[model samples]
Target chain A: MSGHSTYEPKTGFERWLDTRLPIIRFMNDTALDFPTPKNLNYWWTFGGILALMLGIQIVTGIVLAMHYVPHVDYAFNSVERIRRDVNYGWLIQFMHANGASMFFLAVYVHIFRNLYYGSYKAPREVLWILGCVIYLLMIITAFMGYVLPWGQMSFHGAVVITNLIGALPVVGKSITTWLWGGFAVDDPTLNRFFSLHYLMPFVIAGVVILHIWALHVPGNNNPKGVDVKSKADTVPFHPYYTVKDGFAICVFLLMYATFVFYMPDVLGDAINYVKANPLVTPQHIVPEWYLLPFYAILRAVPNKLMGVILMFAAIAVLFILPWLDTSKVRSMRYRPTARLYLGIFFLACLVLGFCGANPPDQPILGHEPSGFMLLDADINSIVWLSRIGALYYFAYFLLVMPILGLTETPLPVPEGISEPVLSHPAAAPTGAAAAPEKRG
Target chain B: MSKMLRKGLALAALGLALIGGQAMAASEADEPRAPSGGWNFDGPFGKFDMAQLQRGYKVYREVCSACHAMDLMYFRNLGQKGGPFYDPKYPNPNDNPYVKSLAKDIQVKDIDNDTGDPVQRPATPADKFPAPFPNEPAARASNGGALPPDLSVISKAREGGPSYIYSLVGLGFNAPVPAGLTVPAGKYFNPYFVGDVSSAWHGKGPAPKGGFISMPPPLAPGKVTFDDKTPSTVQQQAKDVAAFLAWAAEPKQEERKAFGLGAMIYLFLLTVIVYFSYRRIWRNVSH
Candidate 1:
């Protein structure tokens, strides 16, 4: 479901294949000649960066699986062997472990970029929803992958998170028992987690194919956040974007390599190094950094069931984000008032992440003198702060968007992608050399 | 996209409120902040100091080893390629004379070759370090109901990190209880733990800054003698053991960093060239 292909086979064998299957033509059309928005900026490069990271993870993971033991008794020791005994096994293991963090880092930026530009609006809702689906899959896949290590954090993390599913009312207990394959997290649990962790990335890859397919249908959303009026607004996707994306990918990899090679353990929980024990519980169990925001949401509310609901709802709200943000204007850049709230929302998320990593009831501020009591509930400042953050998180998506979208005044619109390019002298060189060539 | 759809989505989200109830009181205390200084293996170029690790091993053997188990490490591990006692003359720990002697110092029970009965014998290079206690229950029972954690990965396991261990062993005992601080009966007041609660207070009260830890004062000045004639000051011993534990947690860290430095150079150069090629291609077009 792309635009008509302009490709014609040049040789006899190529012609025969083209007529028979057209697979080569599909790649040629999409990669070489597909029209893409020229105004797209460095933010759009994250899609390519993400694709690179996924490929890195898959390759490293395949090699690691060659040596990783998924059995509960052997899993922790096997990882140690990889670190100490295996060839450049250290590099491969570090790359895979740190790769998970890099993947999440890119995905977060990509998701937020879409939000800022209103890329999820209108015809792109299906694409956005598919992205959200991939995100959910990634989370599940990462969680399962974490468990396969079978260390203290891995085992206990599996116990704590899997137990959250038991908060469901009627069938929850049965589902939990069924999931564990017995009464509690045991050998069977580790085995299943390993199997699913390996399988989920492929499912994610499948959905990614659809996400890109959907993008090709409507083409890309640009910084302008407006539909392309003509071919003038677009250029062939290959040389232009490929070169830019390639450069961005390299820069991204440079950062990732620094982490993988030097500070491999920085992003990991220190407790995960200890082998799993059923009898002892860590003082505080934290999920990986990527899951912290939602973890904060879960802990914000006191009720177990309600906390679960809110945590799930935080993600659920993202699915309907397109409908919630009713603004006629697509980009938040042009909506001054909306920008303010979005900035606050960003900090709120960071604070939530910080709180999630720390003890909930730990005093955020200095301890007071002897008998200071204003509100008994306010004793734990950090927990109360997280609650406020959670409140704003929900209200931003469900409340603020609907009210602001219809009310805010958007700046004057550009007639086409070239409007600003042509008006500004510094950018005019590009418009003069480039826009007409595509527009023709 | 439509009014009904919007309402439906909102209602679904809004319905989350119906499940709202009170939160469980947070049962956590502030974790100790890791004391920061440059570690030998801190940067991209850092490597483990072999001599320091040897000293650390002495401290572990003399003090911490009584209660803690380092299950993953064998006596031979100390003489392996990246380990502290590793000698270039004998790269394989199994071939190292020092490791052989160390292994033979401990006895392990194994099935007898002829009689098929469990028998005790001196450990060889291949044997794992014997635990001080046979099982978890025995270990717990001997240690005032607190199981001294396994040391093989303790430097990597605890939140405040190996540096925190250094702080605890070297400086933790020096911290006096604040004027208002009142530690409970069973807990020892150490700055590195969750915090010592007051004897009269329930668990819900605000945790003091200097937290509760189970281990009594273990390391002290002149506690362990160093074979290399390094003075066994508490600070020196603490740092050495911390260094050794870091090595135990990930012995290949030195090699990893060395390779990283080279890889970083190659990648930075390759990426720079790729960046230039990107610019060259983009010169004809603009975005």
Candidate 2:
């Protein structure tokens, strides 16, 4: 989000280097002269927080890989050696492991912020897709990275996810076998996962560059969803957002550090501590908390193939979000009808996450509640309740969005980014409270 | 009235789903509780007690070491910083009297230097703890289809950690079987451990399933003598060994916490400066 670059090379070396590679000019344009929205709120800071997390993961991951051995027999012990024998190794492992969770947490906030402000509309579509692509890469990278520890959960989780691929028709078995490189989740799987786990971060960094480039092209979509009318709506990214984002990043790091130092195992599964055994599976097979919503979607459908498709389609739907949201108005601040449904959609996702974390065998409604059918399908036990959650999740995008856009009356919007803030001095305690400040 | 009805219906639906999910969640909360006490290292600020670690090592050597192998440990580790036998006089553990004597007691498999032939000799301080079993099959064969897991990271590897270990080795043995629960012919009762008790799985009553462990309760009232005049009771031994294992799991715990404190202090200061800087920069901007 910037005006034309006003950066001019001053020094001889800078001038010479600018002509050769324009690297200085590029950095100046993106970091210094870039015009971010002046009215951007605290939610806007997560984008910067995510970038910081990515850097932390990469640095700590490299150090961890130096000491980590990938052999199945030795993998668990090697990790122990890092924690015990290597100097400052426990800190590095905690940083890398907890770093992944922090990265996901910030990215989730970033995405929800986009959804709230309709940041994916029209001109910002490619930027949004590139972001979605980055999210996809992160999921893959984190999944592979989890397997390198060779814990029971790590091994079984890999087997379960790869086995999901086997749900595909015809050539699924061969593909699954090829993925595992043996009849079961074996030594070679761990080896390949470690290599890809190391490599995927660089790939993510490449896509992240593209994501930022696409973002800078359109400038930021403010909470008002109003385009910048004049230079008054914008400020240079360096002094304003740099300080703001930097502050948010430090706070975020502090929170992450608390978990790493005080209670590292709180977010992790205790079952994963045990070494992987092919003969035994954990009593409760669950994925990491971040993957719970998708896992719920996968289990919601009883059929294997359909479950896999729906889980993927849940993410794929994001690519078409701009179109799916048929509203002429961008911000949900004005669209009361959409906001109502969005609340339900948000709650549904949380419920899905809850369903995912718990075992499906637990009987719902205090007793065994079964045979609740929808669309000729039997909804059995607590798993069926997840279907209710998944239904709203899909419907929020496919049905409620398109229909609400056509029917709902939106509250009046501010004429510009500064309108609400300038209009009320004492009355407006927060920018969000004075939102939808309609013109008289 | 219609608008209010619609809103109420939405709220009801949301409430029902959430409550239903929580009910199911409550029923599945069956993780066995483990006892945790009497350790030098228990919290973020806690550190290992050197005397306890030494006693724990003695217990491990005399009793547990007969069956389990600590594959990741070197004899020299005994004299490393944060370990039981670490004496500052011996910068090299191989030269330390305690470590050297322990290493010399074991015969290590190696290659002859001059003849390039396979040979065996007394181990040096640098050597890893030798396995009691030659291979996986042999280990399983000796232990009735279950291989004794390596002790290197067992503290960190299990669900309840050292607390679970203490409970399993101390309170787990000789406990009366719960009502309606029968111990099958080659199995033993151990409430702290959840193992391959297919018997309980089939004949399930009030007794929880899969609560049997093999290896036949390795610790007793006075299995290993303590050097520092501490009681050699099973409970004391269990607590000591648990403390030692916690150190094994994360020896750098204290260092990590120390670094985190410094980093947190720096970050707090930086946040303060940046917060002020943000306000100053935004002062001129109208929006």
Candidate 3:
């Protein structure tokens, strides 16, 4: 956590304003003078990358909304018109569409980094939960945003996902009907989705403020996962992190621009170019790639009701992850056994994503009819692979986290952030230079 | 009206017509992968071959226009920047004599201001390319229940862009119906069309690699005599039209890539500078 304000008013106007609101001081304390851990690595850059992505999505989305016709009948053409007719509209539209993917990419990295460093433990629980809330809102926003295009995939994806609510026992059908604003996903549904799609980002922005506030209170979690013991363990955030994050962001933008300029539609499905037809459905109905892992989990359970429950539960489990992880050691860097499980957990998630992108009947290892039959599907099928993936996904959290934490023999942890920096091999060769220096 | 507002209104009208002209049926999947057409517009720095686009336009005007529509395109677009008929001397597409003449050749449906009755008028460069069928039902009826889709974004709407179009028209349509499969009364066999041929397949272990398309092969060798004196083989015709459609799908693609080159270079430089700045700033800290 940051110490007392080091800001001193330098001008007459500043002195007056500081007495009136202290807003400048607040900004300085939170953004510039904040004491960030000195050992934070490139993984920490994702937080800054995520913030930039959100801003990009919001700004581009607003421009798109200006040219966009929200009605289902017009949505597809409106988008095409933007790409074909509007000035630099192609750039804006591509950025917004691909921005959703980029946003998720950054968030996923941020989450995984949190898991590896145990950033969610103890004082950072509230920060992590707020992040989960923002992530949840992002899913809802991205889903609705996709529907605004009214492409074949957009319409059918909405229909399939909305119908999941209908799997409930009693009020399921009514809830779904209410959600759709009719008996089916139609013009009214598109209207409401547009409204919410436009609204959710600001809501996310608000939660993001909370997320940042919570983060600033606990400060940053370093790779070493040790508390900052003194002033020597930290650095001013501005020139150090801002410059690093800026460099990382520019590199990120290079990848983003490549997709935007050269292969704009590669991340998108060709089927979506077809206008949405309620009378017919696409051969494969898949959600966007970011949400694929959850979709895989949902379909992994054969029972519709159970599938829906499991899908929701997967995200819900993240909300309680801080408590579920029983390891006393914060970073996997210290707990070698726990680190292995985390690696497998990450792999399971990717397998789930692969499964989600494909049809369940499709074979993973070989051609269909692999001469081995499992429950309701071939043993080699994506469905079976997804089931195994889903099981590991849940077990990694529920069983592995708790059990491994209590049993794993952790490597000796450093006493403070400075100790790791001082002892590192790179620093050992330059002991005098690496030694912590006292600040005035 | 101000020029900006008029342009905006025209674009809005074109957008509306495009939505109104949307085709209902899904273009079935391709079984055989479409080989690369090796189009001029194939890569990051690729530019459209002006002669090919002009030839492609001739094919569209003479052949595809009979059954298909390109509701999103304006005649002026033909002479706009990067268009098939674009002339560097003519900054305004409307003033391009060739584009103007092409527009005047087509009779578009309109209303007479004086008589208040529907009339046919020679189109201006600003006019949208007229629809082949007035409505979807009529198109379906004429095509035996399969409506030919609007070609404005056909290259983009389908997978593989120009290559897919080239393959479907030139190569796939001519493929022999495998021994077991029966071509239905109206439908033609297309090896590139994506569909399950299982129901129609009576003789195979796996169903043959394509699906039935309502439209018969529309191109033949020398279908349209080229203005550029290029050979008029069926393959050449297919490739040209595909290129034209790709250009039509996103006329501003060249502009996008040009702008991206600068953006990529700028970002690369900024990243390097910032990276060094980070290094210089962190040099003494040694964390």
Candidate 4:
């Protein structure tokens, strides 16, 4: 059955086109002949789920764009109409909104999985870098989409962010004006944001294709640190992985359906219901949850330009992680000391994200102010937490892996495929004869 | 193999616990009740007794409906208690039949045509109160540069919200006279007024100051009687209308509160199940 030829080219033109494109052959080879490690487990499935979410977002976004009006006066009302009057418009809007949160949720898992398994090491560096690019594009797309509603949060957010650009030295004001297409964030700004928000998702879809292409070259990393050395150590991607990935996707969809149908606004902001008003401001400003950690870093620094640059650099730093960590082992399983520290580093990142979402606390009383000193005991607890987390974030790549590579002792290595005790246990003799060496 | 499964189970358990904790934290903060003057609503807050709301509903049904619209609120909402409309369940019920009879004349648009124009008919239970003008230009032309805004969602749209509405309604008392502006005993100046402020007639407006408000104080003491002996002051009426407007803006208030409660419970149970499932699935595995 596997060897049978299913296709027959009737015409010379069709055969010629097939040779040039080779689309079906490419899919079969990468998705079939690709040798995936047997011990990948569930965590590795998140990359495929993230890709599915990206597709969901692009399709829903295009449909929404067809009905959404971009003018400031009409944008708010248009959303209301979509909610109340259009055919199943509420479901579409809710899916697009919540799908964004889910996409981020999956990507976070994907990144953490990479970190735990050292998927960024060696030849897989390009895959990790492309993933970072996709992450950046996702951020831009979500931010632009947030402003298209022209609600109170959208209007104020646009103002706050556009003003940040004006903090630049020479042509700052002009740049902001050009961005707004006016003196302030008004009708023109909303229109342009609508256009770009509609455009960026498709751009992200393109980047995701590149991300998958990069992943295919090195294939996937698995739970075991050992590389595939024999047939038993690997499996073809066709029946095995195709079935596994398909099952994972179904389970993910069930979880997604719960949010889409039951609690659509679970991740939405309340203030967004109010139409745009230039004179008013929301009591607090926050970006979406996926942006929280970087936003925390941006707020951690006192200086505006420094904060902006540091926040960006924090993300860009991930691209260079392959070169930064000098460890020879590919997975944390082989590096016991580094594994514990990396787990703590991951926890710190989660904590930073939570802090960023909540309101920043005031500094405790009776403490001296510290100036630009990286470590200051007198600063607010939140500031300290952010600072420490930021330090660990850099240290994980800059110090821990390299130091462990030289000093730490690894566990006993497993022998070749057929030699492990469990794989090749000596058979017991018949009941009485099996006890021959018991006295010794 | 068992060790890998155990690690995966542990991670899933942790994620579920975190989600459950967040849901519990959020539901505690989302309880719904009457607004009790916090944030922007503090200081010299006006009263909005049931009787006053009844009167405001009267004024809305009668005088305002002549030229203004409230396309956001439903007629059935009038039956709800503690809102701008008189609650039928109030201890001393006002003459609702009289009010309802008067409101019967008002025509509201019930459906939209293929061209997206509202098809007008007598107001129904589910229909939002109709606007006085067909569109923005028509509203502006009729109201002398005062384009009456749609009252639907107005309470949520403004910064100070109901307070702003109340304050704006009661503006123009003890207002200072501008240079070249004429002084009248009862007229109020509106900033949005088309004519020059210098030549405009100044009067005792609803509150203290007025720049360009067009409409005069429509609610005077004794204009409408309250069954509960509450004073029918304009301030009281303003408060009632503001409260009513808040409800109009978020008609799903009750549903939101209920859903929040259910979600909290569901998350808690799911968390517990996930914890045990993790234990069960990983019992034989070493991490």
Q: What are the RMSDs of all candidates, in order?
A: 6.9, 6.8, 8.9, 14.6
lDDT over C-alpha atoms for residue A149 of model 3: 88
Error of 1 at B157 (Å): 1.4
lDDT of 4 by residue, A285-379 (tens): 66778888886676555455665677778888888988876665666665577789888888878877875664333232323233333332235
- Residue-level lDDT of model 2, residues A284-339, one tens digit each, is 66788889999888876656788789999999999899888777677888777787
Native contacts kept, each candidate: 0.46, 0.46, 0.47, 0.01
The C-alpha local distance difference test score for the whole of candidate 4 amounts to 0.62
Best by TM-score: 3
Can you list each candidate's DockQ?
A: 0.29, 0.29, 0.25, 0.05
* C-alpha DockQ for predicted model 4: 0.05
Candidate 1 chain B: 10-residue stretch with minimal lDDT? B15-24
State TM-scores per candidate. Answer: 0.87, 0.88, 0.93, 0.63
TM-score result, candidate 3 = 0.93
**Candidate 3: regions farther than 4 A off:** A421-440, B1-37
Q: lDDT tens string, model 3, A1-440?
A: 76699899999999999999999999999999999999899999999999999999999999999999988778899999998778889999999998899899999999999999999988889999999999899999999998898988899889888888887899999999999999889999999999999999999999999999999998998898878888898999998999999999999999999999998888888888888988866766778999999988887776678888999999999999999987666777877888899999999999999988876656677554485765455677676898899999999999999888776666656668767543545334432321111110
Give the winner by DockQ: 2 or 4: 2
Alpha carbon lDDT of residue A139, candidate 4? Answer: 86
Q: How close to the true structure is residue A293 of candidate 1, measured as C-alpha lDDT?
A: 85
Query: How well is each residue in B1-287 modelled by candidate 2, as lDDT tens digits?
Result: 12332232222221123233333332221243444545557676777888988888788878878778887788887777777888999887778999888789888789999999989899889898888887889998988887788887788777678887787787777566666666766667776676434334434443353366667878888788888888888888987887777766666666777777787788889889888888898888776
Q: What is the TM-score of chain B in candidate 3?
A: 0.88
Model 2, residue A238: distance off in Å is: 0.8
Interface RMSD over true interface Cα atoms for each candidate:
10.1, 10.7, 15.8, 18.5
**Cα-lDDT of candidate 1:** 0.79
Instruction: State which candidate, 1 or 4, has the greater DockQ.
Output: 1
lDDT of 1 at A364: 68
